[model samples]
Target: MAKATTTIEKRVPTQAEQEAEALQEVMSAVAKNKDALLTFLDVLGELHESGALDMAHGALKSRHQIGVIGMNQLNKSGAQNMIKNGMNTMQFLAQLDPNKLQTMLGAVASGVDNAVQPDAERPQKKPGLFDLFKQMRDPQVTSSIGMMLNFLRGMGAAKGRE
Candidate 1:
């Protein structure tokens, strides 16, 4: 038997073929989302009717002037300082432990609530030195003192870090 002969050919897409493929893909997508596209057009028509489209066009035209004015304002000393302070505040907040801050805030809120509420049952009396000594024995007072001491230590350690 004579040996069989085979030929293989590779074809590259032409520009026209690529454009046709793109058009087909777009048409397919449009067909799939016909209702959505229609609804979007209706909403756009309503926006055009409301004069918002004109405002947007005008804003775009004045974008360069707006940007220049914004930059001028930011260049002012007060604005610059405000931005710096804001950035510093953000950095400070980022460094803090969220759980510890939350706990501290909860305690502060509780203290505020307690201060706002009137306790009629307890008589107001000035505590003597002995009363102060007695308070030191309380667990809550001791815990608060320890926390204050640690806070002072941390504050001291942060010296020169700025």
Candidate 2:
């Protein structure tokens, strides 16, 4: 009978073998994504040609200075007010009924398109006071006036609460 094998030995990979395996995996990935890699390279070349890469590098190098300048600007009252106003506007829009807002915006766009005068008809005469009063009596004009009055009433109520 042959001698009984009592132990099994495991062979560990060498550093060079490990590196070769990693390179093979990376090459396989590159092969699999050849089109994407080529597209990315084309974009990179365009960016380099446009000096965008250099600009990006320069910006990165000056990041700390940029941060300080940004901070300084943001600390100003005007910037603070802009941020506050933006938040208030967003809050106000969020509270509106979406369907009504969509309809209102569509109507506003239509109204603006209708109001635009052709360049050839520049300086068309304004409506006279009597004409304006007559327009106020029109159904569409009355409806718009009512909408504006409701908006003003809501604003007034908000201001009063503040």
RMSD of each: 7.8, 5.4
Q: What local lDDT does model 1 show for residue 68? A: 99
Clashes of 1: 0
Where model 1 places Cα greater than 4 Å from the true spot, the runs are: 1-58, 124-134, 160-162
TM-score for all models, in order of appearance: 0.58, 0.60
Which pairs clash (backbone N, Cα, C closer than 3 Å) in model 1? Answer: none
* Global lDDT scores for all candidate models: 0.89, 0.90
Off by over 4 Å in 2: 1-13, 96-141, 156-162
Q: Write the per-residue lDDT of candidate 1 for residues 1-162, one digit (tens) a residue.
A: 987668767899999999999999999999999999999999999989999988999989999998999999998879988998999999999999999999989977976776677368645577789988997998977987888899898898888586
Best by TM-score: 2
Error of 1 at 51 (Å): 9.2
- Model 1 is weakest, by summed lDDT over 10 consecutive residues, at 115-124
* Clash count, candidate 2: 0
Worst 10 residues of 2 by lDDT: 117-126
Cα deviation at 103, candidate 2, in Å, is: 6.3
